[model samples]
Target: MAKLYFRYGLGKSAQLCQVAYNYFEQRNMEIAVINAKDNETIRSRIVVDGKNVLVREPNFDLKPGVSLYEKIYLRDSDVGLKCILVDNAEYLKEEQAEDLFYISKMLDIPVIAYGNRLIDEKKTSLGVCRLMALADDIEKIDMSMPSKRATLDFNYGAMNCSKTAQLLTKDQSLIDEGFKTCIIKPKLDRDELYIASRIGLRKKADIILDLDDNIYGQAEYLYRDRINHILVDEAQFLTPRQIEQLRRIVNDYNMPISCYGLKSDFLSNLFPGSQRLLEISDNIYKMNTVCSCGCGANFNVRKDRFDNYVTEGEQVCIDQGDNYDSECALCFMEHVMKIDTASRKRVRKK
Candidate 1:
């Protein structure tokens, strides 16, 4: 069956794609690599017959009222004309993705697209989500490995130094200097590196934290090592097309994949990526967190600049000091009612 394989991982999706590449190469199949402008790792590693191949991004600017397909076809006639391999699959827009999907079906050429399942904060798959839904078969590569823990020491204020020093057998130094140094050893648990920052898209930190490395690594590993399992963390940030690419990865490749992430944003609204995952995921599971009230916290609440409840705002806010609270729907409603009541009272006093 014509399948779209989604090998997902926190940093392993590209590895899976690499394995797939190896599988096809062993059979001497011709491949085409495509990706967005931002993907550098996969772009660097693309080789044909043990020789590096340069995959250029096609430039197609559609004029007003022009069709996207026409623009794509104009730029690269080979899209549907021949068997092609695509890397950096997330860059394709929805309509473009649809065109590619139909092209694969009509031409009887296997178009393997490898890319991340999620963007940073959007759940919408860049390219793979749509492909997964439409593909004849699906596969998921899950790599949810256990994390390690360690302890590290930090400096604390003077008052607790003597008591804290007692915990340590050796007296490194005890001068009773004006400044007191307390050692604080905190247990550090292993967490996935959130490459993308939760800042504005245009911010430098956010750009630097892009997930291109994770995607490329997973694809490379999969193509080279024949690994199948894939896992994606913080998947709520994926774009729609990226989610489609993930779906295609599973449906077409027959790889079982697991994705871990928040289901909604700080506002309790579904991110595009999370929404897509909910729609297309074969198995759904919820990782639980609790509210201060000890109730199951399924919703997120945001606060305004003045630390007041903010019911409406932009989809995402990056400024620190903006308070966020996780609550259940019931508690969220109560807070909303309270805010409303407070507003009414203020108006009456005025």
Candidate 2:
């Protein structure tokens, strides 16, 4: 069965050239290489550690237009084309992507597309997004780390692990370095326009993300203002879709985004937004804190006014009756689960 494949990454052109080479190696395998960027020739380099190991130049160019499907159909009919390979596919229009989808589905010809996932570093490539949506299969080519590009970073930790402090420090450092920065917080976290740390440091956020806010659109607006970096606090309050929007902003605008939040709720269950960030973020950092037992804290523990461990409650609570603390896994099991410890008894259920 013919399949439409969308392969994206930083240096996907090299993979496209390799695919073309492999196809040429097979006898009687004819393929058409199209450059969606209208380049007369497609050049690809296998770079390792900032050095080019091999270079592949495929001499073929097909200017994309309304007649693209007709041209491919005619070629297949005349020469029995086995596959169609497209480079710079991020430049493809939505209509062109749909045309390729139909070409592959109707003619039983495999279409493999390679392109950067994003264009400007702040906006997702709509053409690539469309192809990805329509592709039968998707792949990512992880080229050697290219030059330092903007990245999406998720810095997670238990309560009082200084995640917000780190976010604030990073944002301020970037500002001190002459880079414009933006601070954003989910409205679900608090009504305050500023993000404050337990240690008495706070900064007014430039943007407050409502539940239905479009973070990517916000990033585009920030890009126009020359905002170089974005720091997000209480990111766990963001929805999973918002995390994706943050990722798209990083890729599209080439802006760095650092998100600070708890990875899990007090119940030790993953938060949807935090889980999404873990899945897609380019970098993940654990902000370390110590439990009262002097061990590394890995869980957030909620408590009542009397400091009894809270067993269950709503996932989100801010400035509420309960207080929160960080605990090591063993302490969590001992204090909350009342297991393997004679020192403290679990609070009786009401």
Candidate 3:
């Protein structure tokens, strides 16, 4: 049966987005998202805590005294509105809260309202109070509690940190634990459809993601085939949109994902993929590696086959007669950059 649910907390908008993603993913149905802030501002997208969600303004007027229930009821037949999600519902008046109640109860459309629970430390929001009284289900959206939601973890470090090896081992462990797993890697990293580490560890990837592929769509198909976990190798090549799609996949399907990659390029600039993963991942882990000088490595140094430093080139170059070494900051600056600077000075002098 369709019901009204009120989920209230400090930051509950993400949960609303999750519901919207799931409804569309599972049933191929789109739900209406209503921003109840009564600002008359039309927006194509809403930004919630640095994340973007596509949205459209409701068809009917949302003036201060208008009845939302009547507007939704009148348009239900023409628009086929089966579900409704309310954002910033704390701004809703008591009458509007009742309107949502009637929309859910009489019209038989499910309504989920997300809002802050309190106006202050001691008082509850008026709209939240009315919904709390009228809604069929109420949930406190607490992030501190233990949850079964899928985790997005980033395992990153300099080159040859055993990142891919750990990825292979984790995939095997998950399979041994009876969790069905799928491995994927960016096609930009290699031509083959498999990931191989220097330690002789290799695994065939189920998907080789191209630059423009929709990761969520691909994952939906894999989810239908009973794949529960996803492991990504060389994730540094992933685009920002792809990382957002991975975030959506986990929220909607509760599918765990682990990404292994270098945190930065040879120039010490963060790779776009690694930066995005660091921004949004649930957990961050640094895989440690040692430099040849016996210090902990934190940077990548590029060198030609002749053992001379390749200071500047394309950001990504593979199998191009160049080698990459992990080095500590001091050694990299003193051994590579210092010598390269001297060579440049001599060339300019000539």
Residues 1-350, model 2: lDDT tens digits: 36688776666766777777788775658898888886546766666899665354544445644456776777777777888888888788877886676566556688999876566555556676567545555565675665588889888888888888888888878989999988999987655798898788888888888999888877767989998888889998899899999989888889989999988778766687876775577766777789998977777889998878888778886546788898875577667756553321121111
- Model 2, global lDDT: 0.75
How do the candidates rank by TM-score, highest first? 2, 3, 1
Q: Write the per-residue lDDT of candidate 1 for residues 117-226, one digit (tens) a residue.
A: 55553555545555443333333344465333211111111111122223222212321322222211111112222222233111111111133323332344353554
Best by lDDT: 2
Candidate 1 all-Cα RMSD: 20.4
TM-score, each model? 0.37, 0.57, 0.56
Choose 2 or 3, whichever is better by TM-score. Answer: 2
What is the lDDT for 110 in model 3?
A: 90
Candidate 3 RMSD to the correct structure: 21.0
Question: Which residue runs of candidate 1 sit more than 4 Å off their true CA positions?
Answer: 1-221, 304-306, 337-350
Ordered by lDDT, highest first, the candidates read 2, 3, 1
What does each candidate score in C-alpha RMSD?
A: 20.4, 16.3, 21.0
**So what's the TM-score on candidate 3?**
0.56
